[model samples]
Target: MESATLTRPPAGSPAPSGPTARLHVERWPLIGLVLLCAATVFGFFYYPTYPNYDSLYSMLWGRELLHGQPLSFEAYRAPTQHPLAIVFGAVLSLLGQDGDRVLIAITFVSFIVLVAGLYRLASRAFTPAVGLIAAGLLCTRFDFPFLAARGYIDIPFLAMVVWAAALEQEQRRRGTPVFALLALAALMRPEAWLIIGLYFLWCAYPASWSQRITYAAWTAAGPVIWALTDLAVTGDPMFSLTHTSGLAEELGRAKGLSAVPSSTIDFLVRLDKAPVAIIGILGFALAAYLVPRRIWMPTALFLIGLGTFVMVGVAGLSVIQRYLLVPSLMVMVFAAVALGGFTMLEAGRLRTVWAAVAILTVLGGVYYTTTRVNLHVFENELRFRGDSRNALEDLLDNPKVRAGISCGPVSVPNHKQIADVRWLLDLPKSQVIARTDETQVERARRGGVAIYAANRAVLMRTVLIDGMKDPIMTQPLPGFRFVAASDGYGAYVRC
Candidate 1:
């Protein structure tokens, strides 16, 4: 093989400088990026919106903790508790009625942080172009933004994991900071426990005995705190695990280990869409062939995330789509490489050809999205969430509804609206009942404030169970008389 000796610029004479240098120098400031993200969220996200069921439960639990009450994790259809989220909820609970919106705002910021972290990780692993493309793809994936807008804990958990990956990528074996981020993420999701444990092993190979001990402590922090919290409240160290499994069974979300392979492919396709998934696969193969070192960290993350998801199925936990988010994100990074990897190559005919292919792929993706994606449907769904929340609040605030509350508990069609009602009224778990609960149905029918869906949209979305399994849920109680109505809800009193 022919070889040529490489030499540096002589005596530091006129160091390399041009558009590329200026591009490096004029990087966006973190504060500026945050402000830009804030503006975008403010402009696009719906206002007067409440958190989703899981998040509202967090707020309610936080309020309970603030007022020195036990957490009602056993409440009908309550989601599994997340330690960091509860702490955050406790802080936001101080805001009273405004806490819900503030939680959404914080989630919006978490989404921004997630995007930023993805950009940083991708850029460090690949190039700036790839990083920007990956971040853009993530933003365009509506599921992620929807989760953030609804205040799902997954967004912040994702942010912390991505940032941890970024930090580790910036400097291999970056000890405490990366562990700290992963520890926080662990508090949010059990998946991070596996990640942090693996990371500890990687760090241990190069550390002193004391450093190993510290790393072990950080690795244990998430599960220990979680178990302790569960033990303290529910009197079972394994309450979260056992409770989540039972709830998954009740909700029909448990798919089992046999479904993992198919679920993995299905969820990836759902998150990244078919075209991106295909491109990401191709990109992974190509990067492995040409630049294994650069791709290794993201590849490790992809595998770990996939493994964690499979374990979730094995452990009989909820085998839902959100659990695949981290792997899907890594797929986005690979897909970006398929689009922008040409930038990393030296200027030549091969590079030109690859760049042309990338451009054509972009056009194809844009066409596919334009033809298949319905922006209006997404808009209306988000609008309904905000509108329904406001209407529910209005109904609860009605004079007759308040008077009926004094007479007896407030009852909803099912567990769907239980958290929302409790959060809105600051009512105890016992004070807001689901008609689906056979134990409460008799009491609800006797006397109380019964809330019903006021329109078709609300009826389908809130009152009816999945597949309209119970039509009677929307039927009016015999003795209840209509007292007041709002756009999406109707109030009746039996007192």
Candidate 2:
């Protein structure tokens, strides 16, 4: 059918032709849907590398769960723990162990579902075919697709949110399924609580009276269940508070100041990595401008989702582009509706516009992913290593080592300091050093931190400003070591 592109075509314009001319014809997304799924898989699983440090954090939570560290709480409040990603990791552990491979597989699978969910979400607003079109655009974006490549929670959470939204579009007979999904969403990440909670309230206020009440109750159940479970297991209402608190303090991020100019610029830089980000953004703006007042209510759903992310996001302790995860999900849905309403000429035109966006986004994203290789990212969760994991293995197997374990920071989640503690324990530190303060280093390694990890710049800054002393000894790590040392990550052994 010709798309409903322009709100008001010219008065004498031939009442649109081709697809729009054939109004009696119905549109379905059978083949388009299959292609959509494949496209997402192709786009997301570009790299089969190791889980980033954040992924390792979830792995660690499973370990803690194995060691009786309740689900609601952990000794270390790493970012990867609270969400449903932890539960998935724990379940993976239950099914005999294949650490890296299994975890990577989970990440890959999540992306496929993510594509399918977007398709379904789009199907609701326009023809099912238009939903497929939206998925095609989304999979093409570099920033949105990578979450799929590594099975990180951001993509999974986005998938769940999309599904929840799609389900919201349908008429429901019960609150059970609704509550269950919200719980699943919350299980993915604590931030989801805000999104789903708001979703529930909206469902109740001004909707069908009884239905609204039911939806609100369903939505409320997620946090309530989480709270009860936390109390039962960890004696805390909000789990991961301690670690999360420390992380926020370390980063010096304000409560709701997500609109920082530098950080916003950083996001624009990240967006520049892919044409898809830019493409989809333009498509969204154009589509929104085209929408007639008649479709305002339907469009309202997408706009609300977009507002939720834009309003609450942009300021999380995450990489600038990754923040695009939430906003991307919201906009993609709107884009589908926006794309669906196009006139055939407009649809074809949008197709061209979005195609360019997809291609650009993918190329840029891939280039960034392949080049610029460093394991020092303090915010990204998916950590890849060339020799680091192996070097760590060799050190842990040494006979001379006694109670040797290294500790260092990669990223902070749950206000928790440091990265990859899960990897730290499973992989053990031979002798660790941190570039942080004496206080932080001491707390992280109360068991006796021997060797230290620091960049030359970190040392100079601490020495120049803080007036702190030196490490008893210093060593190098990976590409460039800070100073002369015995082993990687500055393995300091007790004499």
Candidate 3:
């Protein structure tokens, strides 16, 4: 496709007019967005939480780097490290115990950036009204906020990619700024490698040789740095790919190519929900019919996102919902267009009827959300994440538990708590063992401090409910005397 400038209404369509149009066209759009993001941050400030499992490992590895220690990427069930995340982790690790919460704060900022990027892209491609609707839809999707709150690297990765796309939409062949953002995104997720590569080709033909070389260098940085990092630490350039695949298989998360079709549909429905999914399809069709050029980028993004998801499954990596985030986001944009793109039409009966349809669709969505959405479930989950982490910290900080750690390794019920315990205590891998490992069962039995769930909720979520089928793993080791207890966790030492 030829590079095109920012989208304008098709041919002779009249420019937006009247009060509604004036409201959308003014400076208030950006001001309103700023206020919304500010409110969101302030509202959630009190509920500061730690990183998710993968992100915690990033901080741990970063701490190792900061202290001149080799990264333990080869540790059992270790997540693949992203270059930029590790760098941020190394910087944040300087904060010591407060690093985790700071990382989460950065994630919240990234989420805001993502929402703004979505608005900019959609608005530039269509109108400010569509942009506002897109932003609203994204905020309403609880999963996006939930991911941001949990400090998932995916949030930042999405932010970079969305902003890159928005910049490109603002001015086609945007060059370095666009490539720079995607390069940063590529450091966070390998999926961006594909995006940046395709973008390089798209812009290459119109560029001089030097520009192509620069873009190529930008394209190679993410994977090359990742490989070198892996090779330096694990002595295998392919360690991340192989290790992640093996881990996925072990965890029963890798679904093969045969399941891609079903998984794609299922994940999209889950992300966008059924009502928005149906509306997105209609909107996508309407946009395609009305102005194909306007939606080319979104259309390409939707396809590329799906293509990468398929590539992931084919490569034996874990096939999860987050992989489809790009496409789901496009669905939100297109759905916004269906609901508000009519505003771009010249005043007429057709515009009036379409506007009425949009209003009813929104009302129906509101009704569906009101009846089906339960705020308490989201509240409970967020509450548990904060509560559980605090409880684990309290248990680990207890003097008795600290004294017991000197006896031998610290053992948890399974791999779920490995990073948490290790990070909390700043202990080496050998110093922490998961009782679920058959080899470690005897070691755990021999001597060490073992942590356990303090209550039914914690037990069901942590110890008893793991991928391991071994019932014996959850049983208390013989001779372990209770040492310390906290609201969500308990500790015992066999020494």
What root-mean-square deviation over C-alphas does model 1 reach? 3.6
Better of 1 and 2 by TM-score: 1
Can you rank all candidates by TM-score, best first?
Answer: 3, 1, 2
TM-score of 1: 0.94
Candidate 1 C-alpha lDDT tens digits along 243-273: 9999888777647898788888999999999
Q: In model 2, which range of ten residues has the least summed lDDT? A: 408-417
For each candidate in the order shown, give its overall lDDT on alpha carbons: 0.86, 0.49, 0.86
Q: How many residue pairs clash in all the candidates, one count each?
A: 0, 35, 0
Best by TM-score: 3
Error of 3 at 253 (Å): 1.5
lDDT of 2 by residue, 69-102 (tens): 5442443323524545666667766653357557
Off by over 4 Å in 3: 1-24, 466-472
Candidate 2 regions exceeding 4 Å error are 1-48, 69-77, 80-83, 95-97, 170-179, 205-217, 228-246, 253-255, 258-324, 333-387, 398-492
Candidate 3 residue-wise lDDT, 1-495, digit = tens:
212232455422344689887665766677867787786677467666789999999999999999998888988678888888998999999998999998998899888889989988888778788889998999999999999889999999999999998888777888999999999998899999999999999999999999999999998888899899889999999988999888888877747798799999999999999999899999899888776777877888899999999999899898999999999999999999999988767677878899999999999999999999998898888888899999999999999999998888998888889999999999988899887777777788888798888888887877776356464455567898998889998898877
- Model 2 Cα displacement at 232 (Å)? 5.6
